[model samples]
Target: MHEFDLIRQIDSFAADHDDVKVGIGDDAAVTSSNAYKDMISCVDTICEGIHFKRSTLHLSDIGYKALAVNLSDIAAMGGTPRYYLVSLGIPAEWDQEEILEIYRGMNDLAKRYGVILIGGDTVSAQNGLMISVTVLGEIETNRSLLRNSARVGDIVFASGTLGASRGGLDLLLSQGLTAHRTEEEKALVIVHQRPDPQVTLGELLKESGFRIALNDISDGLSSEIWELAEASNVCICLEEEKIPISADAIKLFGKQSAYEYALNGGEDFQLVGTVAKTHWPTIQSTAKEKGIRLSAIGSVEHEGDSQVFMQKNGERTRIKRTGYRHG
Candidate 1:
């Protein structure tokens, strides 16, 4: 397909919104901002071979995950996503219909969160397909959840289970796409491919009227907690048993391997952060009411070495900052 034809195909996915003055087809996207709120913007890129394999994931899955990962950043900041721009590096082998299917996957998730497609660029690539997404969001002024806000004596909690995404990726790599998968394996694969951003939970935390430190688990739990500690200039101690793991992950990968995934495997996309201890009961209760699973797996301590410790069976060991890192 020609460039304009591809642009037209993408344009069909744009939805009208009051905040977006000019969407696709424009030289630049013009958007209105709320004076009462702070705008949060984040960009993420996923590349073939590096982030995913075309052999395992469908084109639509790649599109969905590309947007989902960016949304997770907005959720980490406790913001409401408003608009996004997508830039694609299209390889010569890809067709127009396949490209449009990617947009369809993105549109499915965008409609759920009321995020509108604005504008972006598409370019020809010689090597592999690459998708870059830029997301813009709004948060209460001065109330954006930050990584550096953790205070001593605060309770550190994580939303949802960890390690499932890593397990899913492993299954895909080992078993191939067409191989038969157990029910648990299927669930894991789904988690890895189409992670649900915890936007509602993030907004709830922001509305709790408490200062909280939040970070999304794009990396593993160990790496994320270490980020929280180092950013906040505090030490964090986590109870291994308190870390939430899906029964599916445990059953499929075994307890030891599952915990390893939780600690070191990346791309779970769950939120992990610290909140004031006194405010924990209220937040936990409210989250439970919303049917969100939250676990207080750790606590923040006075600054020592800005380290993270994992406690297992009465033994405590310092964990290294290890997770998915781009080279």
Candidate 2:
């Protein structure tokens, strides 16, 4: 009914962890990760209507995504997510059951990932609900992946097919769960509603002894590739044919729109990274063994300047570093 009561109810769902020196019900959460390694921290926030439509998005999904997106940041650095703090701005209109369902979703996901919901604050909002999640993770200082470490001779790769999430959003906006859709179309809607962060794959890359540079594809493939190139001071040349487009996306949006979605659609939550030519074989082999769709889409090379370009047919076209940006 009230703010403190609601916080107490949510806090009861938090799991215990030894590394958490101080957890919920404290002034601030205190965590002690590995002393020898480095700690990675990331924060992400989503507001109703802007990030999700209440007409189609469930409260459980909103809670899951609020944490999943932050976990994606930890995964991009090849780290293990350990702890999280969730802050919410709850509107007065939402019933208590809806509020509890939010934490139920987050607690389930945190349990799956061994993450602890340490502490956070909940406040009243005049209008829509807002969720802000801060995630803390750890990784070996030397093994932590960097976006700018790509080398000229490295091969660029992307994990999983892209653009289905955007297609899903289109369906949700246009149809609102109507019966006149294919199974593939329904699956795309689920992808947009609930995204899976690539944490295990990131761990695999770190443990394989492969030298690499990495970043998760949150904004878009083209934009992320540009970040990798700019950070590593190398030019990336991608073969348009090599970029993996989801079959569902093609069926839903046709070839041209699907490719555009793959190139510029945001929130896919896949990894795009670079591996040296010498280590690409091992990485590719291991990824296949793990049943991960890791595809080589491009190459890193030195040009007059560092940039990203797509090669189609015989023409070379520059890729714009454009993607979804929060205002």
Candidate 3:
């Protein structure tokens, strides 16, 4: 491990890398500000034990998800991610290819979102592997959505389907999918490893006078909706029948597992947005125009005890858990 932590040395207030023209002493590096529309900044961390397991995943997947998670945050805020800053903590004895493989993953996502990895710092970790990324995005200021902007009477929408990630992870672990045997489960494995951040859809919402109470389903649908309700000071009533669970996901995992996985699972990385009920058609058309599917699953109700209700078969039941809470 490197004796001096570069990030730690920069932690001193006097050492703030302000001259660099962007974020310095933070989780992921960032730029000063976005030139176009509104600027959004978000950073996410993936660790060996918590966010991911190196042995359980390939080097490429570990690299891709490390940055994809941050991009997902930008999408949740309804912004167009333009740049990324990456930091890596590696073991001293690790092979040189480790770094390249990680970049391969990050670059794979950056290519899809049209973002660039502007800069970052690297250092030796005393123990396990760690990767952090910060992404900066642009959006129209007035249209830039946030979690707190959710409003009562607004419709809750999710981009594309959900639950494939959780299902994929389960299959990989339960079946011990090796690099050789995973081809049969390629789609399942891909969902868990290389999740697509809904940037286009998020940008569409930002430009179309939509985008209120934005959040990405990184944790789970129920969890994100609960957060939106808390931020907007409202209650979200989700229709179970309306929640868009993907058919491929159901085929990979059974109905109950898939439904719960979609509801309370993590890492789906879908965009969840709120908007006026009347604008449903526009959202749909816009999503289609952008090549994403937007599904309306619920509505925001007047402020009360924060809770999410799942309605099925004309019966509404309180969902005991809202979403995942990271320790």
Candidate 4:
């Protein structure tokens, strides 16, 4: 880190805004008012040996991911994150600068979305670090996106590409990486390190005239899609070939590897949103403007088996795996 590294980074992110009463390097942050009828709140935590392997990740990336994952929850609900509170149990071995670096990463992400850290508590743990973050956001009183709103004839779409984060994890785990290594691999590392939550796209979907079931693709796409179908009480019929996977990651890992990564691997954090058949064009247009690759992987059918399917060569293939889980 350099001089005013955190502060300058925050300024660069929101340099043009006047509503920032306080930003990075402050004991506390403050923000100006924004209109909202009710607030939505979500909290998430990542414990070492549970959420991640300490040997495999950098402290800064861990910090960024801690905030990003919670923000994904807020994004899935079509809310704007207004405030965040972080509680950390650090190991005694870590130093002050190391703690600051974690804040530095969190600051980098929170300020990007106008989220301010309001308050929290910190303490030392005897074991690995555990981070608990709660994000409070707001949506227009009755306009929040619900997981139960998907209807027949509604088209389901995902923002950005899938499986890249998973592939990136593979790349990080396998030291055998050689040849064809370039900036593309680096991009996957960035994707896994600092995921971009789709807050803006979720807001756009919450606008009038669109069918409204929404969820974030944090778990493997296969599992999350099944979750949506279960929530809405419908069948999701889609083609695996049509899912928007990262070209770079696919090239990096052959077809089967890429497909497995997309289906079972986790941590993409993109939005899996639904829109009416009539509103598909609007959905596409909105995604284009937001720089999110909106692709329709499937559609909801009238209540049937609680499953997601892939059609290939006039036959059906049932998907397995409930995403990354612990016993």
Candidate 5:
């Protein structure tokens, strides 16, 4: 199919929103926003070889994840996602139906979040398929959650369990796509394919009006904590036992491997950050009422060389960047 025709087909997936003055069919998207609100934007790209393998992942999974990762970024800032634009690098091997399937995947998630499709460009690629997404979000003016806002003597916390995505990736590589026979295996694979961004939890934290510092756990607990410490200029000390690992992760990968995955493995997309020590109880209660898992794993110490440490059995060990990184 021709590029213009393909774009016209993809335009069928766009959603209508009152704020949007112009949508997918234009040179650029025009949208209105509340004067008291601030806009938050983030972009993420996933390539065929670096991000996933065609043999293990479906075309729709690629589309879903490309947008999901960007949503995770907006979530870290405690913003409500509004619109998104997708730029695709199409390889010759993919057909028009496959491309449309990718858009269908993106549209499914967009509808759930009330996000609309804006404008973007599509181009031909020589190597493999690539998808890049840019997401625009809104937050109350001056209320943006930031990584640099953590203060000394603050409590560090994370939402949901960690390391299941890494375990899922391992399973996919070793067992192939159809080999997930058990419930645990299937759960792991599902997490790897479709990560749930903590948008609601982020919004709740913002609504609570607490001064907090947050970073999404895209890389790993250790790496993200290091980012938080560095950005906030504080030392973070974590209790080894407090890190939350799902029972399914432990059951499949064993206790030790599960811990390793929580620390070093990446792509969990959970939020981790610091809050005032005194405010933790109320925050915890509010999150609990909403059925969200918020775990306090550590505390911020006096300002120093921004560093992170893990305490296990009375031994404190300095942590390094051991999570996933692109070369």
Candidate 6:
């Protein structure tokens, strides 16, 4: 079958919506946007050996993650994801069944998030399977989150637990799946394989009309904090004791490494944001009502020369670059 044939097969699974002016089979997809809302778009890719190992991760998981990561981007911007374009580089060796399974995974997530598959390109790959997803979203212009909005004296907060994904990856790489491993270990591995984007939490923050700064933790917490501080022209102080470390990470990587994973390990997909000191109480209360685990990790300041630091036991240590980076 030709590339277009395969694309048509995938398109058969997509849902049609009124917002999509043009969808698959066109040269490019067109989506309608609200006049008052700003559009947000981001792209994320997953490769065969680079992003995942076929031996460790299932094809469905790879498909889910390809879309999930882009969802995380929209969440970071406090936007609603509406449409996506998926470009696939598929090797000849991949069978039709495998391809359908991948689309099924993506469709399940898309249905849950109310997103539609608009259109995309496909090509034959000489090497391995690759999926690049471009997601489009929208949010009220005034409520859009920005990396450079953290102000001095703002309280830093992290959504949900951290380090589980990184720890899970490490465990899978080192030990593989074994009968000796406990259920906690298996759960850690699942975290690495499937990450949930915090879209609801981001929407809540935007709707609440609180002045806040937001970024998703695709990179490690340390790297993300540095990015937020540098972009906002402020310094951030993270309390070591305040950082959320998951029990699974501690079980897999031990205490010290668990803390390191929380601070520097990447791909957690959690939300890290800052709120003004005065608004922290209300926002925190609302998050509690929503059953979201929002934890205060630090505070922002304008006095330091450094971008970020970890303070513990009355000692402050400057944190350097400590997350994954593409070459």
The sequence of per-residue lDDT tens digits that candidate 3 reaches over residues 170-271 is 777776657554343677678888999877777677767754667788888887777677657787889988888967777767788889889877799998
TM-score: model 4 vs. ground truth:
0.85
> What are the lDDT figures for the candidates, one per model?
0.85, 0.81, 0.75, 0.76, 0.83, 0.80
Q: What TM-score does candidate 6 get on C-alpha atoms?
A: 0.86
The digit string of per-residue lDDT tens for model 1 on 1-327 reads: 355467667778878887654454321233456657767777789999898898778888899999998888889878888999999999988789989988988998899999999996888999899999999888766667878789999999999999999999889989988789889999999998788988899899999989899888887889888878877889999999999987789999899999989888878889998999999989999999999989999899787669999988999999887753221
Q: What's the distance in Å from true for residue 291, model 6?
A: 1.7
Question: What ordering of candidates by lDDT runs from best to worst?
Answer: 1, 5, 2, 6, 4, 3
Query: Candidate 4 vs candidate 6: which has greater TM-score?
Result: 6
Q: Tens digits of per-residue lDDT for model 4 on 15-94?
A: 54565443432112234445545566767789988887655467877888999988887787777888999999999999
Identify the superior model by lDDT, candidate 3 or candidate 5.
5
lDDT of model 3 at residue 322? Answer: 50
lDDT of 6 by residue, 225-303 (tens): 8767866878898999999898878876788998888887878889899999899888888988999889999999784
Point out where model 4 deviates above 4 Å: 1-36, 176-181, 324-327
Instruction: Give Cα distance to truth, residue 112, candidate 6, Å.
Output: 1.9
- Candidate 2 vs 3: which has more TM-score: 2
The TM-score of predicted model 2 comes to: 0.86
Q: How many residue pairs clash in each candidate?
A: 0, 2, 1, 0, 0, 0
Instruction: State, as a TM-score between 0 and 1, how close model 3 is to the true structure.
Output: 0.85
Lowest summed lDDT over 10 consecutive residues: which window, candidate 5? 21-30
lDDT per residue for candidate 2 within 1-327, as digits (tens), equals: 354456567777767876654344321233555676666777789898787777767788889889888888778878899999999999988788988888887887788889999987888888898999999888765567777679888999999989988998888888885547779998888778777888888888988767788888778899888778866778999999999998999987998999998899878889999998989988888888988889999999894477999999968999987854221
Q: What TM-scores do the predictions have?
A: 0.88, 0.86, 0.85, 0.85, 0.88, 0.86
Summed over model 6, clashes come to 0
lDDT score of residue 72 within candidate 6: 85
Between candidates 2 and 4, the one scoring higher on TM-score is 2
Model 5 lDDT per residue over 219-320, tens place: 889988987887678899999999999678899989899898888887788899899999999898999999999999999997977989999999999998
